[model samples]
Target chain A: AQTVTQSQPEMSVQEAETVTLSCTYDTSENNYYLFWYKQPPSRQMILVIRQEAYKQQNATENRFSVNFQKAAKSFSLKISDSQLGDTAMYFCAFNVGSSNTGKLIFGQGTTLQVKP
Target chain B: GAGVSQSPSNKVTEKGKDVELRCDPISGHTALYWYRQSLGQGLEFLIYFQGNSAPDKSGLPSDRFSAERTGGSVSTLTIQRTQQEDSAVYLCASSLRGLYSYNEQFFGPGTRLTVL
Candidate 1:
């Protein structure tokens, strides 16, 4: 069984500042994928970024990037130059690459608030 | 190209009643998934469908919960005898491929279900 954990229940950052949301997972599978998703008040779940466990290089998408520590089983999201639009509920997810079923195991979301 | 879409953005139903949530994945996506977001449980995988293979129902909470994907494009999640605990946002996502493929899953604006 695999599990994802987001220790921070809530986070706040000022506009133009940087913020990092921490995430950790417990999985025995060597081949897997980790992801970060954002859910706004509109209830839309948006994919922020993703990282492949086999790849040593971390994943980056514009202002959003991930610090993936495979050995530590930690995948944290870094949001640079945060904006009000960044306010949302962020989730960390995990999926096994070898499994036929692509079901994702998600962490308890961390609510982010960007203050102007 | 249009992203995943869900119908009945908001649904209000009474306890013991039945409700159906629909999801339309991307045209070429071969994998679709259903997830539930609630206060008690942040985000949990409910079901998964990939191409013509057997759907994975392992994540379903109980027998009252069931889902079906027709023609490998549209999916409907049926919740029978809904309870207050079933009040949550139902999210759907789709990806290009399944199994070994690490395609990013695009999500839809979830259907928020409120049980009164």
Candidate 2:
């Protein structure tokens, strides 16, 4: 079974600064997918970024990026130029690659607060 | 559908009562999943349904937790004799099928269940 772990239960960043949330997972499979999801007070879960285990290069979105170290089983999310809107609960998830069982296993989640 | 949708955005039920939560997957999406999120916690996989294949219920915590997807579009998760521990946000997600596609799971606004 795959298990994702987010060490930090809460994180805070000053407005316009950067914040990095740490996540690690334990999985026996060599190939898999890692994802970051954000849930605001509205309670809507939205995909933030994703990384494929096979890809050596990290994945970057508009303001979100990931530092994926496959060997270390670490997939961390970095938010640059953080704004108040970035305040939310973020979760890390894991899934096996191209398997018939595509269920996602998620970490406990980290609540991020962007303070002005 | 425009996106995955879950019905009864909030549910409050007494212990030992039965509760049913509904989900409507995005149109054309063949993969649907259910997840549970306890307060201030990460998500836990509950179940997954793909096309007409047998649904995966491995993540279900107990036999009291059962889900069914009808016509491969709408799903209902029922918790019989709900317990206080069953209080959590129920989330639903869907993704496009096919081995070549990126396994991006789009999530819905979850149903918050509060068992008293």
What's the lDDT for all of these models? Answer: 0.91, 0.90
- Candidate 2 stretches with Cα past 4 Å from truth are B98-101
Cα-lDDT of candidate 1: 0.91
Q: What total of clashing residue pairs does each candidate reach?
A: 0, 1
For residues A22-111, could you state the per-residue lDDT of candidate 1 as single tens digits? Answer: 999999999999989898988788889989899999999999999999989999999999999999999999989988876788999999
Candidate 2 TM-score versus the reference: 0.96
Interface RMSD of each: 1.6, 2.2
RMSD of 2: 1.4
Error of 1 at B56 (Å): 0.4
Residues B1-116 of candidate 2 have per-residue lDDT tens digits of 48889999999999999999999988998989999999878888899888999888888999999999999899999999999999999999898872432578888999999999
* TM-score, cand. 1 vs. native: 0.96
What DockQ does each listed candidate score? 0.70, 0.59
Checking candidate 2 for backbone clashes, the offending pairs are: A108-B42
